[model samples]
Target: MNSRAAQLQAFDRLLTIMDELREQCPWDKKQTMQTLRHLTIEETYELGDAILDNDLEEIKKELGDVLLHIVFYAKIGSEAKSFDIADVANEICKKLIHRHPHIYGDVKVKDEADVKRNWENIKLREGKKSVLEGVPKSLPALVKANRIQEKVAGVGFDWEEPHQVFEKLREELAEFQQEVKSNHKERMEAEFGDVLFSMINYARFLDINPENALERTNKKFMERFQYVERKAKDIGKSLQEMTLAEMDVFWEEAKTMDKRF
Candidate 1:
């Protein structure tokens, strides 16, 4: 096992470097919590991209970038005579001990689902107004819907099985199609949103992260499209100059090389 004291020393080194940079580096001295917000979000996405690509080296670098942001924020807090890095770390540490009664106390849990239930129940006891209140409002719609469903399901407010979710999805889709045929744009939009929300809920029933799954499909489509473009170049043609039939030959060939196949 790793030495825990060595890990603390490594973090202390980061804090020391942050201190030096704040005092000496012109750009570092200027950043505030508000100014760093967008950069932190961008760094987070880069880390996500590295994870999805399965590039361990890129993952390490992106993780460092995000860690730097954490230390930076803590340093800013220290400057304002507020909570610092130690406070941030200790707060989460205390929360973990509070939330994980199975480890920290005598509470018994039979499975992962029971643990999740306990976690939500513990939050309610800790003064959270609602389980849904924990979901970030800025989350992408599909991901947000999945999270909302999961939070409510923790308290037993959910369909019993995947088939019921699928049935609800089909109902929503039918309503959307009816509105489309009627050419009622506003009603169609509302119905379309319902269809999407139902589909996300169904995805949750399948134990899928809809956002990650869709991004994976998006990556597959991009790779196949790029391959089709390369094949067209080899044939002295461009996509704009080719008929659908001509382009689809390359598309089909690309599909044969797909990772799943």
Candidate 2:
């Protein structure tokens, strides 16, 4: 681990490199925040995958990538005479101090929920029109739904019990089933979305991140299916040539292998 002084020196080195690149490197020089936006998003997902895999080395590398993107954006901001890295860093520092009254002020909190309630209330006092105002409009539906539930919950707008959330989920499922029976395509779609929203809320009550859980299942399925494909190829058979039973055998093997690993 680096000392605090060493850490600050390393960050200064990064800023120097960024400045050189922005001045001398043609690609870096031509880059704007808008031009780097999609790349930043891709790097973020890479970091997410690293975190999910619990790969410390990969996580460290991804963090550097993300930090570089931050520096790049800050450089662009400085060039435009808008703001620089210090301004960006200070703004968040101020926000954190303001929001955490329990830590920075005389406010007392009994639990994590109390802290959250204070944070949301502070945001409102900071001139936010609604609790949901901070949730990005461009977030994926599943992630957005979770954020919406969380923000409202922070302000005490939530079910009193986990079982109540489960009951709502069940009700939504019943409505979805009714829509399916009616065979109205549009209504069924709407009902299906409601079911998903309810499920996300229920997952929140269970302390599970629905996005991470779903992505883990997706990765698991891909690995197992790929294992099945490899087994079929070893026997000189394509997946299309393998019967369901044959694939199931490899799938079972993959499951066993996963358990061992």
Q: lDDT of each structure?
A: 0.93, 0.95
**TM-score for candidate 1, residues paired by index:** 0.95
Clashing pairs in 1: none
Q: Please identify model 1 stretches exceeding 4 Å from their true place.
A: 259-261
**What range of 10 consecutive residues in model 2 has the weakest lDDT sum?**
238-247
Task: State TM-scores per candidate.
Answer: 0.95, 0.98
Candidate 1 global lDDT = 0.93
lDDT tens per residue, model 1, 1-261: 449998888888999999999999999999999999999999999999899989999999999999999999999999999989899999999999999999999999999889999999999999999999899998878878889989999988989989999999999999999999999999999999999899889888898888888989999999999999999899898899999998898889889899466
89-197: candidate 2 lDDT, tens digit per residue: 9999999999988899999999999998999999999999999999999899999999999999999999999999999989999999999999999999999999999
What shift in Å separates residue 245 of candidate 1 from its native position after superposition? 1.5
- Which parts of model 2 are misplaced by more than 4 Å? none
